[model samples]
Target: MRKTAHRMVWDIFLVNMIIITGMPGAGKDEFVKVAKSMGFLDVHMGNTVKKYAYENNIKIDDTNIGKFASDERKKYGMDIWAKRTSKYILDEDITIVDGLRNYEELEYFKNNYDDIIVIAIFANEEQRFERIIKRNREDDIKSYNEMKSRDDRELTWGIGKVISLADYMIVNNKSLEEYKSDVKSLLKTIIDSRPKIREKLGL
Candidate 1:
């Protein structure tokens, strides 16, 4: 049964997943926008968390959502979000997963899928805080103190370690145009190199 189940998973998953992770305001959403424009489908872990909160009659604010995600991790193990998110991805050639939070989730994908590339976006703390203030998303941090607190919580979950181990790194501190151009080039490179990646993976 275990062998059959593993075979089922192997048969269901075909192609590479680019898992994107970064600090709260590190422009991962912007990177996903660029990837989507280049015809990549996206699965946002943040959206998964938000959906769960909505279905459970929980408030969708940052604090509530943060607590909810943390509680679920505590209950189901550190990779709970990855397990939940993986069910939504089917046989897309290249899917991007945004908002990865920890090393456990990274490992879950690596162990199950085997054909995933991890990308980490980087921005300085001041720049990230500035962007967060400008975006004002429903669950975005409002102030530097709030951002710092959120950063602390995420780092505690091993996000920093995951970020350090990414297969690719993109810095997002420059102007929007420059950042978008860089992202576009990288996506094209990844798409073009798919055959080589597949060969390396023995796929």
Candidate 2:
């Protein structure tokens, strides 16, 4: 189809860039929360998929629709989401992003933004699966296997490469207090390490 060709061509034409990656329910959102509370802004890529799903009346429970939203993104590239989220970055002093799963998406961002940070948050597979089942955003997924399927789909979507190339990693496997503490500590380190963060904000 024409759509598929566009995605392949876009990938070939675009440069690969930095991105933070992890499976669903890995506290990518929570990390964003910590960042925002500490003066950083937050944006989520999944909002793009969710918005497309909503406009088309694609029930969150529709696995096929989720597949379509993801597939359609391959051609135009996830920068579609990055472009939207970029608007928020301009409105803030510091920013953090949630829901990255492909290198092309990351590249689109790094090429446009300066001093971008790619932080990956991860937990054990079992924990992430349990978290997804409980989230139950889609009634279609009610078992361990169903959650596994979602994760596998993301992996196939190029999530692994993003994770492997991350500049930093956070493993979420402890109490919320501990995780929050780690976030603060890690963020401070990243801030100190990246001059772009301070330079852009005039800090």
Candidate 3:
């Protein structure tokens, strides 16, 4: 009976992968935070880029970070970030990857994992701008024009397509508590449904 239980646990771990996609300031970070609290191993693609920047002594500002991401994509491939991030996922039961920007990244996860789910968090332009202002991250855009420009750049990377194609969508235009509640509920559903999902997928 102990052996059977151990095998079931391993089987579940082998099939759990959640990939998160959203635009900047859309609460992707918050969602990943909640997932981490629930014991999911969180991987951020932006962190991978930031780490690369730090390692190479590149300026970690918004323009330099964006340029570095673009240059790496052009140099390595469109899925360069995903490739780098995947290496860090080591034997985690439920791995939640944040910062999926394009279809290529999505496809990389899909091709590699048998059971993969994508969740996109969204907020209105005004709401996202407000969050950006409130958070005031060093890499965040300062003006409306800058925000729009960043949006255009991410859209050009096919973030819109990934957002539209997500298995689940969370609109985060409300209170933080409400958003956290919604995320908790969604995570519960995903965790509870994993076994049935694996069965259906024959994993």
- Tell me, by TM-score, which candidate is best: 1
Colliding residue pairs in candidate 1:
none
lDDT of 1 by residue, 105-194 (tens): 988888777478999999999999999899888988888899998999899988999999998999998999999999989877887788
Q: Sort the predicted structures by lDDT, highest score first.
A: 1, 3, 2
Better of 1 and 2 by lDDT: 1
Global lDDT for candidate 2? 0.67
C-alpha lDDT (0 to 100) for residue 92 of candidate 2: 21
- Residue 194's lDDT in candidate 3: 78
lDDT of 3 by residue, 51-138 (tens): 9989989987777888889999999999999978876765435678999999999888777655789999999999999888899987
lDDT, residue 128, candidate 3 = 90
lDDT of 1 at 61: 79
What lDDT tens digits, residue by residue, belong to model 2 across residues 61-180? 637655765767776765566665544444224556777777877886776654466778889978787677666665346677777787778787788888988888999999878999
Model 1, TM vs. native: 0.89
Residue 104, candidate 1: Cα error in Å is 1.0
Could you estimate the TM-score for every candidate?
Answer: 0.89, 0.79, 0.87
Which parts of model 2 are misplaced by more than 4 Å?
Answer: 1-19, 62-65, 84-88, 138-140, 195-203
